[model samples]
Target: MSTLPLLGAAMTVAELEGLQDFILSRDRDLELQDFCELGALDADWKPAAERAKALLQGYKGRLGIHGPFWGFTIASGDVEIQKVVTRRMRQGLEICDFLGATQMVIHSPYLTWDYNNLDNHPGRKAYQNFLDYTHATLDPVIAYAEKIGVTMVVENIMDKDPDIRRILVEDFNTKALAVSIDTGHAHYAHGSTGAPPVDYFVRRAGNSLQHIHLQDADGYADRHWNIGEGNISWAAVFRALGELTSNPRLILELRNKSGILPSVDWLKARGLAE
Candidate 1:
């Protein structure tokens, strides 16, 4: 297998230094996943912005960006919600430009409101309507991303079906729009014995897998377990990746509150991070 690139989910500026330390001081393979604070846009966020930029410039590692999931709803049918989503998406893309982020990760809007519980689910007509609205709302944002040379990666969420990824990639009809497969979310939705039939997904996605968020989980729930702590077979996954020859950005989107460095260390000890 080709060398798999590693990355840390830098949800805060403080985490970037740790990532730098891991890659440089420890000789570990890693990159940085920038998780920008959308709420800080109105605040004096320039310092964080500068720090993020510095990490991108100094770290000698590939960069990826995760957009704010709480406030942004790119698929909202409501006009007001759509406006907010567009504004936030534009802001996030601008941040990506500054950070030189190759991919911008986005969460599909949660099922809310009256028709919210009905988006391409159960394969019904109402769900199809919801899908149409979502595609309509996201086209402008996708165009904007293309103009700036950024790939917009819509992620899978809890209770989301696997087919949605295929639907989005096929319907969007743009390289700028792609999928950020979140292993944790997929495990939460599917049984967590292993990945969500990733071999099938990889084939279905073809070249649309722009990025990946790797975390482990048990069949019971999505625990964001470190690389070796859960039922996942990293070696097997890497084996598939080798066959596919699609080395999408592999970001370690684990629970950083604890177990983050230990996970890196575990991979290092096994020569997985070399």
Candidate 2:
């Protein structure tokens, strides 16, 4: 376990101010939590982007942005809603291009309820509808991402069936599509909704897993606490990661930005991460 597992933090520009030197020394799997609001990428975007670029002038790391995910669904069958979602995605790409980011996080549309209902219909018409609408909504953005060398990693939100996203990425059949796991999200679903455990998510995602949000949470909610503060088996999670060839970016996503270092220390003390 002392193999020096790569780990980094997901934070805003302000939070990164004093921590730049630390990140410079560790794994550079940095994820920027900016421009993730419903309309944050429009007029109120440039100043923050410029500030972040200036702050990270000499930082050479794998950079990613949390794509706009609030108040929109990519699997919407409504033509107008699709247009809105498409605009947000394009806007996110604009920021990614400016910041030289290679990855963007998009939330999955598969709800916990979908497991039972999606296949209940004859011939799985409901599942087919979800796939059809999702493809229609994302095809153009994914094409643009591919052309520009950016990978759009589909993140599990309320997704209980781990295979659904893998199948969606395979169906798309493009280099731009990949999988992302938020540990806290999986843990919450595992305890509350009967979803598989976090370690199972890692195994299920397999080589397609491109990014992970490294947060610890009680099974009660998406607590986003520092690692070692939750009931999740850190050893089990690391063991699962050990079997992966993807080398996914592990970004500590905590609500309290100052918890990043302590979380890393917890993992390091246990010989699970460095």
Against the reference, the lDDT scores of all candidates come to: 0.63, 0.87
Model 2 clash pairs? none
For residues 128-231, write the lDDT of model 2, one tens digit per residue: 78888888888878888988789989998898898888888888888888999999999998998999999999999999999999889988799999888899
- What is the overall TM-score of model 2 with all chains considered together? 0.96
State the local distance difference test value for candidate 1. 0.63
lDDT of 2 at 116: 72
Scanning candidate 1 in windows of ten residues, the lowest lDDT window is 26-35
User: After superposition, which runs of candidate 2 have C-alpha atoms over 4 Å from their true positions?
Assistant: none
